[model samples]
Target: MAHRDRISNLPEELLLKILSSLPAKDVAVTMVLSKRWKFLWTLVPRLEYDHSMYQDDVDGSSRFSRFVHSSLLLHEAPFLESLRLKLDHYSCAADIGVWVKTAVKRSVRELDIEINSPSLSTPVLLPWSLYSEGCKRLVTLKLSHTTLVDTSSSSPASFTSLKKLSLVHMKYPSQDLF
Candidate 1:
């Protein structure tokens, strides 16, 4: 009598569905389970990057940023269903912009980004690409503790597909920008 890995024998679609329910960190860990799952996590449609989880590391912010960049670069999903980023004070504006742009290119339907920066002087500015045609497929967008720059000049049709939008502690460049 021998033990068999029944779960591993499941179809890739089923495995992917299972993997999708796990956090991005856990999903990445699955790659080491076996060769069959080495590239499977890359196909998961949802990615959530929370910087707070890496706070224990010496250079947590940098490590977290690198992790996010690597994850997005390696992601192979044709259509990303969701992208969530929970960043702390040390998160950089450039990295945030890149993450959002990448998600938009992937046709992400749901986007949730929260930045916790205690200082009012260093506000993270989202990329203008977020208002481009690439974001036409976006259905839900949530942002916090960031600045929405140059929104006044953007076309009103930019967010036509958006059904839900949530903004908290967001800064606007001008009072009439809305």
Candidate 2:
């Protein structure tokens, strides 16, 4: 009699569903468990990037950027169901814009971004224009510590599908925010 790997024998769909419950980073590391899981992480529809998680590394910022870029480039989800980013001083507005655009392009339905720019006298402005008409599938939006640039003219339909919205310590450039 020989021992069999029951978990490995599980269907790919079942494995993916289980993987989805873990953090994105943990899911990625599962690749080292065996060859069978090498591509499983890429199929996950939910992604989360937190700068604080890599603060101990010397090149954390750059590595974080590379990770995000590569993840977005290699990800093969039909649509991103959720994306959460907790960025700090290391990230720039341009990079944030690019990532947001990429997520929106992938039809991310839920977006949660928290920018901790404590040192900045001026708030980092979020490229809300990227979503003015792009995120038609967005259902929930949560933002913190970032200023929203108003493009009110086209914003009414932007978050049309949005059911839950949370804004914490968010600044609006204009008094009117749609």
Candidate 3:
């Protein structure tokens, strides 16, 4: 008799569940670990990008932009249940908008945007689709170090499936956010 080890033994559903626990960056790295997991990450339902985790984001270089851009490209659409992003620098704002647009089109269940901007003169604008019909499926949202340009046109959005929300250092005028 011969001993055999195969990913098939782990079960497809079980693998997907385990992969879901990892962030988008980790998932991307894990794909190279084994051929079995090449597409395993594709099925994961969560995506997280924290700029703080990157190396030397303080300089506000194009590296941050590339990081955000790469994450969007690596991630699949629609099925993403959560998208947590941290942009600590203004340099990445332009790329952040593009990333948000892609995620919004997918109808993500939760959106966590942390302004990685440490210091800035003027406020940055978030991709203003809150009033658009495309983002109706978005239930939960968090914006830190950011400003909501207009609330009048924005629909009443909440994390329908969202159970908890956290705000770190960003400031907003809305009394409703706690």
Candidate 4:
């Protein structure tokens, strides 16, 4: 069936439900299908931009980075309830921090960052300033598969609404995080 015919038959509620199931990036691209569906994305309440969806189990660095950029930069997502990210192995920790901070600044209730197979260097460690930027509204923060840095430069965000905090695959001295 043609694009117009198919969409014309579907109800607006159905379209919103289907778009809600997909990531913000996919929903943005769906807009090009027709003008009637252009603003359908704005009604979606949940936005999930998990980069792990691009994991090929063989090579994922380039693919994941591009996916992340597309989701964050190309979409029209507004005030997401939660931001879930799986940082690609080859990506710099600094970039991940930037993305998280952007989400928090937008009033995200839950921020989850999952890293897989991280790299280490003399000067390359988790960016501590991400938390120092003052994320008072963040309710839940989860950081996984990362190298926790010595946070001497700044302390963790006050995180007043934070109730469920989880850290996974975090490689750091016990005292560093304490």
Candidate 5:
């Protein structure tokens, strides 16, 4: 009697659904399980990156940033179902912009970004790409501690499919922009 790998034998869709429930970092670790799982994480439609989880590390900020970049770059899902980012003061505006742009490009249906940086004078600015045509598929968008400037006059910041929007401590350039 030998042990059989029944889990691996399951359909890829089922495996992907299982992986989606886990954090992006934990999902990525599944790659080492076996050859069958080497690229499974990349196909998972949901990604959650929480910087607070690595606070105990010596260089957790940089490590977390790198992990986020790598994960987004490697993600192969045709349409991302969700993208959630919980960042701290160490995260830079440039990195945040890039991450949002990547998510928009992936046609992410749900986006939740929260930045905790009370000490900083200025918050990270949301990228113009977020309001562009690429985000037409976005269903839910939640933002916190970020500046939103209506930079895209051409696209007009439309979220046709958006069902829910939550903003917390978000700065806007003008009342007219809303």
Candidate 6:
């Protein structure tokens, strides 16, 4: 008798857990292992898109952008545990807002957005919706090398469940973020 394929027969939940531990790019690449894993990465709750990983390749930046767009569009997770984007290029301001909005709508618990578009004179403006109370479920938020345009006049606009917040090299419309 032939031995059963134990690894391939593992429960979907277990397989997803294993895949979640890897970087998002690697997780997506696992589709070639077998047909069973072709769409498994879409269920992962954590996603990290870092453009710096492709700095050596001439077309890496554009490819990275495409990967992010496709992954976000196809993700089937009910709620995202984390969404991280570290972009170092220009001409993607609009897409950034859409991505963040999607994550916010999914009730993401952790969000890390670091933009390094030094080629532009001004930093990209982060969507103001991020500061809205709808994102109360967010536990952690980190922003770097970006601009935040908060036009709200409310005092103490806060994230109710936020446990951590880090802002570095960021520009804010005002000093009322406290």
Write candidate 5's Cα lDDT for 26-107 as tens digits.
9999999999999999999999999887643485458888889999999999999999999888887789889999999999
lDDT for each of the candidates?
A: 0.83, 0.78, 0.66, 0.64, 0.86, 0.80
**Maximum-lDDT candidate:** 5
Alpha carbon lDDT at 66, candidate 5? 88
Residue pairs with colliding backbones in model 3 are: 87-116, 88-116, 88-117, 89-116, 139-158, 139-159, 140-159
Better by lDDT, candidate 4 or 3: 3
| Candidate order, TM-score descending | 5, 1, 2, 6, 3, 4
Q: What clash count does candidate 5 reach?
A: 0
56 in model 6: Cα distance from truth in Å? 9.8
By summed lDDT, the worst window of 10 consecutive residues in model 1 runs over 148-157
lDDT (Cα, 0-100) at 103 in candidate 3: 81
Which TM-score value belongs to model 2? Answer: 0.82
Ten contiguous residues minimizing lDDT sum, candidate 5? 117-126
lDDT of 1 by residue, 51-162 (tens): 7887545744487888889999999998999999988878877788889988988989999998877454545666665777768888999998888766455355378699
lDDT of 4 by residue, 13-86 (tens): 68877877887668767766667877676665456665556554365346666666655654445565777776
User: Is candidate 4 or 5 superior in lDDT?
Assistant: 5
Clashing pairs in 5: none
lDDT for predicted candidate 3 compared with the true structure: 0.66
Task: Give the clash count for model 3.
Answer: 7
Rank list by lDDT? 5, 1, 6, 2, 3, 4
lDDT tens readout by residue for model 3, 1-178 = 8867565479877876777777666777777767787777766777777666667646546564686687667666446688888666545445666788888777777888877664644455566564366676776777776755444544554343444455566645453542
* Ten contiguous residues minimizing lDDT sum, candidate 6: 118-127
Per-residue alpha-carbon lDDT of candidate 6 for residues 1-178, written as tens digits (9 for 90 to 100): 9977687799998988888777788889988878898888899998988877764347535777677889899999989999988887643777788889889888999999887774544446555657778787999999887776655557546688999999998766465543
- Provide the lDDT at 109 for model 1: 93
